[model samples]
Target: MPNLNFEFTEEFALKMDQNDPLRSYRDQFYFPKVNGRDALYFCGNSLGLQPKSVKTYLEKELENWANLAVDGHFEGEDAWMYVRQKSKPALAQILGAHPHEVVAMNNLTSNLHFLLVSFYQPKGERTKILCEAGAFPSDQYALESQVKFHGLDPEETIVELAPRAGEHILRTEDILAKVKEIGSSLALVMMGGIQYYSGQLFDMKDITAAAHGVGAYCGFDLAHAAGNAPLKLHNWGVDFATWCSYKYLNSGPGNISGIFVHERFADDQSLPRFAGWWGHDEGQRFLMEKGFIPMHGADGWQLANSNILALAAHQASLDLFAQAGMEQLRAKSEKLTGYLEFLIDEISGNSGILEIITPRTASERGCQLSLLIHKGGKAVFDSWYAHGVVGDWRNPNVIRLAPTPMYNSFLDVYRFGKILEQSLHDFA
Candidate 1:
């Protein structure tokens, strides 16, 4: 990539914003106001700002429920019985999969457990799960419990891969080497699509291949990746995946999550799954039969009926996504994130006060950048928050800033840089 000849000037940022094709999207979101102005928000990695269309979408569902009640399941605008199907096209587009391979249903963690029930088969020597060390706590718990559920000790049945000594990110070569070395003992290759703390985007295509090569199942927790990076779950030969909608998807907090199961397993009735009435063949669903006949594709994985209100809100965001398109969003994202990285480098300038632990390469990261402050730690993070820079602060000393392509602008990043410079100076 060639340089855009960036400069540390408000004029430059304003000019960049003026030239941005996606500039008008900023008005579609509800931002938190600081001192009566929109705060410089860079925490989409944690929780995205709500889209303005959410109210209208929710109201439509409310009206149907008020007038129809139980009839809402068959009548009215989303047809509560199959409301989640409406999000399939957009979800498929974002995930790079066929519509049947994707479904919007339970929360991320719950879906992870549900998928594990079928994918994590512990038998013979291949009974251990492989994952990244220091993964999100919820993932840690799920993996540990899954091991215990099979009457296996997590300590002996879980293989955790970590970064090399004195490094903040894991190397792809090391990860693959470990996969090969632990081949017969590994039963699954599960990890975040993008690391939550370091913000590293693993080479999932390669990782999936390695897992398959070892005869182990592969999956991903895309909580930090789905809308932030380009995904090709189907083409990548990934067995399964799951993600939260509240982060990059911009749905409301605690909104439903998405799941992906490869087409190969779509009609694999031999696979063991925790059966549910909702997953029974739709044609016979109301029959209330004694035998469970699973639906085809990702829908078969669903355990409950659609959450009409949540799907409505999710559908609202996915509408914007469909109109904007991933190709267009990603083109702008690379530039916006690259510009933020450039600005951070310019501000730090050999100061040894902070270091970027996230990968510097565009191919290895997404919207978020994790800055590890060497000196000020939490106090500096608190000052940044006080000054209206809404970024995610982790324990010890790391601040995660994500310049979301949907609602964030170059001017927002520039304003954030100024606040950061002020905080560093004040706390120096």
Candidate 2:
């Protein structure tokens, strides 16, 4: 593709959208309406649009539930016993992990808790947990509860790495230095694969390697990064990770989440985990003996029988992911986001009302561009929404716009820029 002019002009946006290969994918999602018009939704970083195929996939499950009843667990066209397995390949393709290394199960936070129970054993001096400060509130809550559960003081056992004064992004050097300083006291180091508010993509390989150098386990909450970035969790030596499918994955709200356990730890039965019958050996699971025999590998982490309907709905979105491929999706993503950045910069030139807080380097960030409005505040952002622009607003002053390449068109970004300009003028 040629360089896109930074002018917020319809002709330029239309031409770019016309040339976009992934443009057709936009029709696959259901965009909510504001007032008889399709809302320019840029909030896929929070909740993704529903895939058209999702309802069809879910309807099949509902029909089977209605007709087949309890027998559907073993007799449906897609056996529920093996329903989770069906999603394994498709999910592995997106995550760059082997099918055996990934399992689609409970929601993201619940899996985080499950993984913590198994991985976060604080012994001797190695009882500290280091994480990014200002992580998602749910993560903070879970981390605090976990620390308290271990009878450790949250202040002493939990260390939060934060940005420097007046800065909005964390530096890798500072994080590494902190990890080394904590050294033996650190039991586990976990962080968001991408910062939720700042939109900075952390260097997972380096972070994990740093933690491992000190004999600490490293993991990630991939809620924002899963489908938005190319993740090589296995290759990066990520001990374990969890992510929800709703955001960039296009699975509906509260969709089934997934977990990744490194192949190295797959056979480590000595590791402690709170297991259930569903994790028991499938070959003899029906025997229902008193002993708990977990299936080998990531499946062993499962605590209950898979939700077949949720798995099917997630599978529908995964099919689209496999079809588009992450590399291509990311390629278009960078360009589309770069285009949005350029347009924003163009419109804000000399205005000094909006500041882009996300990293300027494409390699250091995802598709999201967090705009910190200077003079204008939430009132200005609200006016943009009034005109059908549907980005998200963080507390205080940040407006997050994510141009998801899989389902968002360049025209949408262009229209957002235009509306934002009008909003600024009106607010002024």
Candidate 3:
């Protein structure tokens, strides 16, 4: 964590922004307007602001489609047939995996089902899957359905772990102990890289190790952690993982999702998978082959051709990530979120109306700070929205604010503090 004395003043924020190395990147994005002004956007965790370059990127594909028509698949430099490769290097860097280990494909939930077919092979007594309770609802539904598809009762086959008592976050030790207790019965250990509601980043490497120790396959739904947190999925020895590109990656809404499969599975043709023509060997794909000779790596998971326009928009943001680098972005993220935490603590003082439920330690969280509101929660959130503050309110009492390092600045956080202070007063 970069330790710097934080002050709750406008001038101090101005100074911090003026000195920020990543400040210029903020201008590269288009912010939504509220009340004739650019809104303070702290909702990147839900949906990211569009990159200015997305227009040009999309137009390029549209031109290729209009000009080349059928030839566009193999004609120009950015051929539609192989466009997925363009984002590989940047995706590899973001995921900390070999290029062959990761590939952009179907949506998050769809990919999860595909991966479960390959990894969640329950045999004999080893028929259990462990995951966090209250995972994103889609994951819950997918897991439940997958277990049911295998003729197992979800209540008996899937274990959902929750934070103990009133705690909002799971301790790493408790997770490991649970893995040990499950022992050989656990066929899979599936979890989110970061808990969506609590904004807690899990110890994925440790969890993976513990799962392997118990002879179970480990994977993660990295929808919240993908570009926001530092991940070395290859080094962690994780068997499989998947994430959507729309949130922290700033791709358009419901854009493509990427998956990582360890190199150890690269040539394992014996593993059962839901095969498709796109997953077959590229050289033999057009031959109208009768057999499914899977591609050597993560590419083997693809079920269909890439969405050219989506990939174009996705590449626009990935190109920015390649230039900016994840390490530098993560450094700024810590400072931005830390400053937000500091200001929240300072303003909340003895007011018992709001509390930050996100983990305080920098390494244990990303940019999002989930606020647990005790009084006037909805009214306070509405006030912030009316006043040009853009954040998301979860059901019950939490408001999620993500200060993205790519486009958000210290000034944004400072302004949000003023809005929050006033909203609290008005609502109280």
Q: Which has the higher lDDT value, candidate number 2 or candidate number 3?
A: 3
Q: Count the backbone clashes (under 3 Å) in each candidate.
A: 0, 0, 0
Sort by lDDT, best first. Answer: 3, 1, 2
| C-alpha TM-scores of all predictions | 0.98, 0.97, 0.99
Q: Please list all clashing residue pairs in model 1, or write none if there are none.
A: none
Worst 10 contiguous positions by lDDT, candidate 2: 1-10
Global lDDT of each candidate: 0.91, 0.89, 0.94
Please give the lDDT score for candidate 2: 0.89
Question: Candidate 3 residues 1-428, lDDT tens each?
Answer: 54489999999899989988889899999999999999999999999889999999999999999999999999998988888889999999999999999999989999999999999999999999999999999899999999999999999999999999999999999999999999999999999999999999999999999999999999999999988999999999999999999999999999999999999999898889999988999998999969899998999989899999999999999999999999999999999999999999888887888989999999999999999999896888898999999999999999999999999999999999898788767766
Give the poorly placed runs of model 2, Cα more than 4 Å off.
1-7
lDDT of 2 by residue, 58-151 (tens): 9999998899888888997797888888888878877879999999999999999999998899999999999999999889989999999999
Model 2 vs truth, CA RMSD:
1.5
Candidate 3 global lDDT: 0.94
| Residues 106-125 of candidate 1: C-alpha lDDT, one tens digit per residue | 99999999999999999999
Candidates ranked, most accurate by TM-score first = 3, 1, 2
